[model samples]
Target: MRVLVTGHRGYIGSIVTPLLRAAGHDVVGLDSGLFALCLLGPAPENPPEFDVDLRDVTEAHLQGIDAVIHLAALSNDPLGSLAPQITHDINHHASVRLAHLAKNAGVRRFLYASTCSVYGSAGADLVREDAPLRPLTPYAESKVRVEDDVAAIADSGFSPVFLRNATAFGFSPCLRADIVLNNLVGRAVLTGKVRVLSDGTPWRPLVHVQDIAAAFTYALTAPTDKIHCAAYNVGTEANNMTVEQIAGAAADAVPGSTVLVTGDTGPDPRSYRVDFSAIRSAFDGYDPQWSVADGAAELYENYTRWGLTEYLFSERFTRLNHLEKLLAAGVLDASLRFQLIGAGCE
Candidate 1:
């Protein structure tokens, strides 16, 4: 399989690109380099790459690509809320355009990295792939819109699979401290306290970053009859945990760290538990190995090794912070496009 992975330098993409290569697939990368400066550790050596944004991708870029694993977008709620229209442009409109281009260029498979966040606030119920979607934020709303549009275009020639991944947490070369487990562990190690901001009661399904990479690898060659236009929630039922439970896990991962519920009683309305049975049934060897405890421990060990400090907690490890800094510094324009200078932009 010759694969083209978008956002190949991102939190999950950095891990997924190497996984595809290790599995004997020829892989190429496409990224706009928005978060290229937001590095926590040494960057991974990527394959041949097209330094381009998702919105700028053309059918010419899809030539000879057997499949595309689309992971490019404004990835989180805060970033999406920062500019909702931009999020819709990139995450929804651009994504649908890419799928059409890929299909027109004879790309057989299109794997989309959707999110479990689409099942926002489905109180206490284990939501399945077919459950009514109620996206609370622009990020989740964009994902739902993309899933609908992409699925509508699926046909005998083009197979589109939607992997609605759980809240990803673990180590990557492009490490992110914005997500729940990573943020908790970073705070625990740096300040000896794990803080929960929202009264610690919102339910979230969490998955390790490596597990997400593995799931994408499986989808690359999954039976088209099984995965075509199918949406699969990608995490186990056992991993569905509340914010309080996650905080305890983070506290336990760091020695002598205490859990603090910081009076943020505004209970985040975006809480839901997901059912991942569809993925297990669809993929022959789908198995997610990392638990919340495992992810927290990994973050703690890596933070310690890297000598984490309060200063490192700025835009360097957080996506929203980094983008805001770029926009403020004029590196990225108001529309989130890079301003070309001296030599042409990469």
Candidate 2:
């Protein structure tokens, strides 16, 4: 399989790209190089890439690509809230366009990296792939839109699988400190405290980045009838934890660190317990092995070993803050597109 992985240098993509290669698939990359400089450690060995933005991807880039693992977008709620229009432009519009182009280019498989956040505020019930999608934020809404529009374009030749991944944790070379587990662990490592601004009552299903990579790797060659226009929640029931419980795991990972539920921001509405049974039933061999406790420990060890600091944690690793800084620095324009001044952007 020759695959074109969008956002191949991102937190999840950095890990997923290598796994696809190890599975004997030839991988090509397409990224805008927005976060190319936000490396916590050494840079990763990237695949041959078409250094272009998602909105600017041309038919030439899709030539000879067997499958496309679409992962590029305004990845989180805060990033989406920061610029909602751009979020829709890139995440929803560009994504649907890519699917049409892929199908026309003879790309057999289109794997979308959707989020479990689409099941926003489902309370105690475990929401399945067919559950009511109540997207609370622009980011989740964008994902929902992409899934609906892309699935409409699926046919006998083109199979679009939606992998609705949970809140991703664990460390990658292109580190992201904004996610729940990663943020809590980083705070504990740096400040000896795990602070939860929200009352710590919102339920968030967690999954390790490696496990997400494994899910995508499995989806690449899975039976077309099984995956075609199918949506699968990509986290185990075992990892469905509250914010306070996640903070507790972080505290346990770091000695002498205390968990603080501030309740400053009140309760977060982006809470959902996801059901992963569908994926398990389909891809029987794909079982998520990472627990919240294990992921917290892994993040702690990696953050310490890589020399994480408070400054970098607040500025570089956090996507919203980093993009804001880029915009202020004139490296990125109003629409979040990189200026051609930098070598990476060029």
Candidate 3:
């Protein structure tokens, strides 16, 4: 399998690309290099890459690609809220356009990296892939729109599998410190305190980044009949936990660290516990190996080994902060397209 992975320099993509290649697939990466300077540690040597944005992709880019794993987007809620229209333009419109081009260019497998945030505030019920999507932010809404548009174009000739991934947390070369678990662990490792922002009551399903890479690998080679035009919630049911639970896990991972629940009590409506039985039943070899404890321990070890500092906690590893810095520095315009001066548009 010759795979084309978009956003190959991102936090998850950085891990997934190597995993795909280790699985014996010939991989080519496509990234606009927005976060090229935001690397946390050493960068992985990637395969042949195209310095192209998803919106600019044509059928020529997908000419010899057997599978397309779409991961490029305005990743989080804060980044999406920074410019909502640009989020829609890049995450929704560009993604659907890329899918259309891939299908037309004879790509058989299209693995969309969807999010579990689409099931917003599913109160005590266990949300599944068939549940109604109640997106709460521009980021989650964009994912829903892309999933629908791409699934509508699915056919026997083109198999599109939607992996509705849970909140990803783990170590990657392109590490991120903004997500809940990572933020908590990073804060603990840096300041000896784990801080919870939203009262630590919201529920979130979490998955390790390596497990996510494995899920994509499974989807790329699974039987077309089993995965064609289907969506799977990617995570184990046991990993669905509350923010306080995750904070405790982080605290336990770091020695002499304390958990601080700043009782803000603000209303966060993005709480959901996902049921991942569908994916377990759909794919035979699919099993998430990392627990929250395992992820927290891994982050602790890596942060210690890499010498945790204030710099790592700053814009260098945080996505929204890095993008804002780039915008302020005139490297990226308001629309997130790179300025014509440095490295030309990529």
Candidate 4:
């Protein structure tokens, strides 16, 4: 299999790209490489790579790609809200546009990295793949729209598979601290402070970057009929846990770490739990294989050995906390967050 991965250098793509290669498939990574550090590793030297923004996607970009794995976007809910127009244009509109072009160009399989966040406030819904979608954020809305577009385009012969991924964690060279598990662990390791933004009650499902990579690796080889126009919520259902539970897990993962639940934290209305049985039934024996506790420990060990704590304490270099970095990715500008941050930095 020959696969073209967009946003190939971002958190999930970084992990998925390597797994695809190990699966004995030829991989061609296409990315803006903006959200991550300069992508390194071996390629065919001349293997396909691109820096085009999603909105500007052209036929030249789609030439000869067999399977398309679209992981490029604003990459988060808060960032999507940072610039709704750009989010809608790139994440929503351009994605559908790119898939359309790929379909026309004879791409056989299309894999999309959707999010479990789409089942916002799912409450006790158990979030099945067939559950009614109630997207609450621009990020979730873009995913919902793109999933719809992928399904529609499938009638035209594009076998689209949507992976509504669990909230991701774990270490990657493109380290992101915005995520719950990583942010908590990074803050604990670097500043000795684990700040809880929400009331420690909002349920966020956890998955490692490698597990997400595993899901994509499975999609790449799975029969087209099994995945075609189908969406699967990836990750363990039992992992749907509270912020505090995750915080404790991270704190326990690192030595001498302090977990702080700020009283100033307010309720996060977008809280919800999920069920992953549908995917297990579909892909039989689909195990997440990594728990939050295990992932936190892994992150802690890696950070300690790699000097990741130095960046966290510096403030300016923290991958997940710093918004200037996000802007540098063409998602936001430095002025936006600090300007917005002053209004309580929420």
Candidate 5:
């Protein structure tokens, strides 16, 4: 399989691209290089790439590509809320457009990186893939839109599979400290505290980055009948944990670290447990290996080994802060498009 992975330089993409290559698939990349400098460690091995933004991807970029693992977007709730229209433009409109282009260009497989957050405010019930989606934020709303629009275009030739991944955590070369587990670990390592601002009550489904990469790799070659237009929630049910539990795990991983629930952000409405049985049964021999404690430990080790700092953790590694900084510095325009001189603005 020859795969074209969008956001191949991103936190998840950096891990996914290499995993695809190791699985004997020829991998190419398409990224705007916005987060190219947000590296926590040594850079990953390069693949044949189109240095193009997701919105600017042309037919030429899709030419000769067998499949597309779409993972690029303005990810996270804060970023999406900051500019809802831009989020819709890129995450929803551009994503559906890419699907149409891929189908027209004869790309067989389209594995979209959807999120479990679409089952927003489902309370304690274990929401499955067929559950009614109640997206609480612009980011989750955009994902819901993409899944609906893209799945509508599925056909005999073009297979579109929606992998609704849980809140991703774990260390990547292109590290992200924005997500739950990573953020907790980083705070514990830097400040010796695992702080939760939302009363630590929201339920979150968490998955390690490597597990997510493996799930996608398997879906790439999964039988057409099984994966065609199917939606599967990635991650294990065992990993569905509350914010308090996650913080405790992080605190355990970092010696002398204490868990603190400030309750400053108030009660969060974005709470839901997800049922991952659909994906587990569909993908034979596939099960998420890392637990919250293990992932927390892994993150703590990596953050310490890589010399994580308060400034880097708070700003550069957090996606919302990083992009806002870019916009303020004029490196990215108001639309989040690159405006840097000689940076190949399209």
Candidate 6:
């Protein structure tokens, strides 16, 4: 299989790209290099990375490719909130156009990386894939819209698979200290404490980066009839946890981590957890082996020896954050800014 992965140098893509290669598929990656994202560490190695925008992709750009794993976008809520219009442009409009173009170009299969955040306020610990979607943020909303666009490609006999991934916790080759688990580990190592910024009760379905990679790899090989226009929530149902629950779990795994309770604060709209029954059913019991605890421990152990601790702690590191860059650029409004400021924009 000749696979094309966008954002291939990103934290998730870094893990997914290697998995695709190991499975014997010839893969090419398209990325902008967004050099600023290297604040956490060095770049993840990937050749044939296009210095292009997803909004500007052409059929010529995709020449010789058999399929596309669309991962490029202004990822994260703060980043999407940066310029709501730009978010729609890149995340939705361009994405829809890409699928249409790919389908027209005879690409065999297209895999879209969606988010569990689309099921906002599921009001339950385990929200299934077919559950009503209640998107809470521009980022989540954009994902919801694109899923429809990708699904539409099925009319043309193109196989489009959607993976609504869980809250990824493990460190990536393209390291991001912006995620909850990595952020917790980074804060504990840097400031000796990790905080749950909100009331710390938000439910989040968690998964390891490797597990997500495994899910993508599984989708690549699954029979076309099984995955076309299908949306699967990639995670283990038992792994659903709360914000403070994850912070507490990290405290248990990291030797020096002291989980801090900063008092009940504001309400975060990003509080819903997700269900993974669809993915499990799709893969027929591809149970994830790595848990959030395992990922937290790995991040901590690596931070202990590697300079990653300093890398994440540095003020300069903020400049490399895509989400932070969006805020500094005033692409986001004041209200969204206030909420994400404490999230490390996490």
RMSD to native for every prediction? 1.9, 1.4, 1.7, 5.2, 1.8, 5.1
Question: Residue by residue across 72-173, what tens digits does model 5's lDDT show?
Answer: 998899989999999999999999999999999999999999999999999999999999999999999999999989989888999999999999999898
lDDT measured at residue 54 in model 2 versus the true structure, 0 to 100:
97
Clashing pairs in 6: 82-331, 343-346
Q: Which ranges of candidate 6 are over 4 A from the true structure?
A: 35-43, 309-346
Return the clash pairs for model 4, or none: 177-320, 327-332
User: Per-residue alpha-carbon lDDT of model 1 for 92-201, expressed as tens digits?
Assistant: 99999999999999999999999999998898889998899999999999999999999898899999999999999998888788899999999999899998879888
lDDT (0 to 1) per candidate: 0.90, 0.92, 0.89, 0.76, 0.91, 0.76
Clashing pairs in 1: none
Query: What tens digits encode model 3's per-residue C-alpha lDDT throughout 153-255?
Result: 9988999999999999999988888898899999998889998877788899999999999999988888888778999999998899999999999999999
Off by over 4 Å in 5: 341-346
lDDT of 2 by residue, 9-43 (tens): 89999999999998899999999888776888788
Candidate 5 scores a C-alpha RMSD against the true structure in Å of 1.8
How many clashes (backbone N, Cα, C below 3 Å) per candidate? Answer: 0, 0, 0, 2, 0, 2
User: What is the Cα-based TM-score of model 5?
Assistant: 0.98
Q: Write the per-residue lDDT of candidate 6 for residues 232-303, one digit (tens) a residue.
A: 998887678888888987887777668887756766667776767678877865789888888888888777
Candidate 3 wrong stretches, greater than 4 Å:
340-346
TM-scores of all predicted structures = 0.97, 0.98, 0.97, 0.88, 0.98, 0.89
Evaluated against the true structure, the overall lDDT of model 3 is: 0.89
How far is 244's C-alpha from truth in model 6 (Å)?
Answer: 1.0
Tell me model 2's lDDT, rounded to 2 decimals: 0.92
- lDDT-based ranking: 2, 5, 1, 3, 6, 4
